[model samples]
Target: MVALRVGLALGTMAGAAQAEGVLPYRDADAVARGERLYEATCATCHGRDLQGEPDWQSRDAEGYLPAPPHDQTGHTWHHPDAVLLDIVRRGTAAVVGQGYQSRMPGYAGALTEAEMREVLAYIKSTWPDRVIAIHDRINVEAGG
Candidate 1:
């Protein structure tokens, strides 16, 4: 009975982990589609190579901050997948609330949820192995 309970518990934990980590980063086709979608939808503000905008850390005269890079140089990897997906779906202003102003517009109207996941996967695919491992850890820590 104890052994059966242990097996069930382990199975539940594995299922939870799978549910939390849903990005298809290893799928080459999804990554390619994501790259193209990113270029079409996000590159103008974030940069063609995900380099983001100049002076991204500071607010401009109008109080809007430039888009931050999605690459390792930026803090994108610091967040778990769920938070990143929310930001993409709701925009920075909506996510940060408290009257924070941003130039980013949510893609909720333009992209489907699966497409958003693809974009995030593409971004993750570009990170170095170390960064990817760190991001995986972040997701684990976030219970995502």
Candidate 2:
């Protein structure tokens, strides 16, 4: 995990404190578990290929944002680790701090914390290197 620590250090600027949102994408077992969880739990709305739903940027008739892609093309990487975890645990309505009604369900009490981390790691695994770099910057800015 030295490389993970190194990457995280660079992303968080070594001494700065931040919410640790980065998952261990390099962990073979974690990543594999995550892929399964994602396909079973997340792929429906996010798309089997992580492309998200069509017109994901637009609001529905109820003014809720559709499921956004988890791929580099989407804004999932724009968020830091804490936010992602919060969203997964609390669902979109709670995280958005708005009355928006997303179809996303909170997996709190359903998936273990490790499972969530694994799932996120799997998602990150799919991003290209440049996207991963951007995500690292996002972590830096988010203080994680």
Candidate 3:
């Protein structure tokens, strides 16, 4: 089981590395661009305010959980940068396998690598300073 978990984690890391480019997410330009993309593409399900859907933790009648908020209130900050990039490029279902169903659509067809990074950067920018610091630590711990 440990080997299987490690294999899956490695697989996720490989996918994230493949999806992300050398673009710096902290760049103001990238963050700004990402904001626009988020407003246009992400706001629908995540909400314009990033509040996400109500009852996000519970599955609906169809067995699909609602989209969780991207803000500090949600678990988004718990994931490292690579995981975020992977989730955006591949969709939440790809990240959460084992028969988990996600409402998020993979943006690989619609978003460029830079765009995905930008979008995630934009989301991170919305997080509080403490959350950002924690997430940064998470990235560092992951050797990012």
Candidate 4:
């Protein structure tokens, strides 16, 4: 009985481990739709390739930064899933505290949660394997 229980526990854990982290939010069609939305709504400022304008790390005289890249070069992947989701839904000020102004717009009313998830999934799918692994670990540690 003990051995059977242990084996079952291990099997459950293994199954969970194999489950795709992106699966819940991953919808290729939705991602494709998000890609269009990203291009139309985000690409101009963020860049067609998701690379922000020059000196993305530096702030302009107005205190606004050029949008940063979404790929591995930037710190986007360093943030956990919830943080990213919130940023998309509520804008930077929601998480960055009061008086923080960002060129990034809040999508609270503009997008449904599924649409937000699709956008994020699309972004995640573009990341390098290493970045994805790090994000996966972050998600795991975050108890997601």
Candidate 5:
């Protein structure tokens, strides 16, 4: 049973790695650029402190999802780095499927891949050490 669990975990890790490839950047400058871009593009709805808005988990009358918080308080970190990047580049609608609407904009034409990595880095940088460590474990398991 223990071995089975280990095998499953390793398999999951390998699959995730295969899917995500590698993170594009690891430097401070790229993270800084991402932070700037996030500030300009994402902060209004997500909040400067990453707290998100009140009732962020609840949808509005129009059926739009409330902008979720980027902090640990929300589920943002539950996603893998690759998934997050896709969401940023393609918009939440792309991931959630058509007929689903999201206020998030696709940064595909607006931001470079490196820029997307930077933004992601900036968001990760804000996380506490524990969360960061978890992310690192995820990266390691994913073959980063």
Candidate 6:
């Protein structure tokens, strides 16, 4: 079972590496679509500018953390593309199991896989070039 899990993990990493470059950050059409999707679906909590909530690092009275920014100021760029997609598709609670609590609800029912990709691409498009380069390196390292 352990070996199987390890194999699956490795395969996932490899797939992530391949998919990292698939985000159409440079594609104007995709980025525009992503922006629209983000505004309609994510702006309430994450902010219209992707600034997230105030004191996002701190837990609220209900013990739930606020949404983090997807811009360079946040840690969103730190994760590989595949991980980001999975989180969006599965929600934070489902992805970070073991009783992790999050207010982030999965969008699997609300968004298509391509739409999810577009949203992520929009987020990435907002980052500075340096951050984007660093994120690309992170994806490469994760693949290896």
Q: What is the C-alpha lDDT profile of model 6 across 1-144, one tens digit per residue? A: 999999999998877656456588888999999999999999999999999999999999999999999999999999888789999999999999999999999999999999999999999999999998888887776762
Model 5 earns a TM-score of 0.77
User: Which pairs of residues collide in model 3?
Assistant: none
**Per-residue lDDT tens digits of candidate 3, residues 62-93?**
99889899889999888887788888888888
In model 4, how large is the Cα lDDT of residue 59?
95
Measured by TM-score, how close is model 1 to the native structure?
0.89
Worst 10 residues of 3 by lDDT: 15-24
In the range 44-135, model 5's lDDT, one tens digit per residue, is 99998888888987889988888899888987776778778889899999988968988988899989887888887788777888886677
The 0-to-1 C-alpha lDDT of every candidate, in the order given, reads: 0.90, 0.85, 0.83, 0.77, 0.79, 0.91
Best by TM-score: 1
lDDT of 2: 0.85
TM-score of candidate 2 against the unseen true structure: 0.83
Error of 4 at 123 (Å): 0.8
lDDT value, residue 115 of candidate 6? 95
- Local error of candidate 5 at residue 141 (angstroms): 5.1
Off by over 4 Å in 5: 1-26, 140-144
Q: Give the alpha carbon lDDT tens digit for every residue of 16-128 in model 1.
A: 66544667888999999999999999999999999999999998999889999999999999889998899999998999999988888898999999999999999999999
Look at candidate 1 and tell me the lDDT of residue 35. 96
Ranking of candidates on lDDT, top first: 6, 1, 2, 3, 5, 4
On lDDT, who's better, 2 or 4? Answer: 2
**Model 1, 49: alpha-carbon shift in Å?**
0.6
